[model samples]
Target: MAATKTRTIEQLVAEYAEPIADAVGLDVDDDDRTLSGFTRLLSDAADMLSPADCTREWLEDAAEALTALGYVDTDTARQAILARVDGLLYEAKSDLESC
Candidate 1:
């Protein structure tokens, strides 16, 4: 039996970021800024989505990472955390939104 190969999250995301960006009419170039920001956002998102972890503290940790990365202000992260508790949340729906 052969072992399966898995891609790093960064590699998988890099592969699709540009075309996905273009498909939705975002003028995202495959330059350093575009690539770096996309990688950061995806990393934070992946950290947030852990199995067996849905506590307020868990969410706060995730929110803090996003704020630290300058992806969201503290207030917006708070709002998102609250919304998540209320069962209203944004999943991986829009690539433009990630940017």
Candidate 2:
């Protein structure tokens, strides 16, 4: 059996950040301050999700971070974040299943 590889916060952030920025038509330079903030948000989110334990606090923190980052402050954006996290969870689950 293969060993499961857990993604680090940095890795996941790097993987998703550009696509998200592009999707929103934001010119997020790699060295930009906003990018750094986004990285922090992503890191925090990843930490909250590290153990695959979803707590209300984690969810709330994530929503706040997204709002602060201007991702969106509506129900739709919250749902989108949940869906994106779900995709990440699916990836993690696949890794575990393969192991």
Candidate 3:
């Protein structure tokens, strides 16, 4: 059988950075501040949002993390980012299951 690759949370964050930023209405240009902020928020969410830890409260925590990161705090932005977060969490869960 082929070996399974387990991705770290940081790796997952890096993989999903662009989508996460877009979802949060961040403009990641030449400067890295926006990306960095998104990274922090994603990293924070990743820490608590393991497959087994996935829940509505965790989802709310992700929204709160986005707000704390000083991104575009709006209903649309929150919904968009939460969708991305859901994907990220699902991938993380799948990764764990495969392992």
Deviation of model 3 at 3, angstroms: 38
Model 1, range 1-99, lDDT digits (tens) per residue?
975344332443455444433533444444513435654443344354444534323333433443343454566564554344222112332322454
Which 10 successive residues of model 3 have the least lDDT summed?
26-35
Where model 1 places Cα greater than 4 Å from the true spot, the runs are 29-36, 39-99
Better of 1 and 3 by lDDT: 3
Tell me the tens digit of each residue's lDDT in model 3 across 1-99: 975344333454555555444444444443333435545555544454445654424434544554543565675654555555556555544443444
- Clash count, one per candidate: 0, 0, 0
Over 1-99, each residue of candidate 2 has an lDDT whose tens digit, in order, gives: 975344433454565555444433345455533435654544444454435544323433443444443556676555555455546534533443343
Residue 7 lDDT, candidate 1, scale 0-100: 33
Native-to-model Cα distance after best TM-score fit, residue 34 in candidate 3, in Å: 22
Clashing residue pairs in candidate 1 (N, C-alpha, C atoms within 3 angstroms) = none
Q: Pick the candidate with the highest lDDT.
A: 3
- Superposed model 2: Cα runs more than 4 Å off: 1-4, 30-36, 39-99
Q: Can you rank all candidates by lDDT, best first?
A: 3, 2, 1
- RMSDs, each prediction? 13.3, 13.8, 13.5
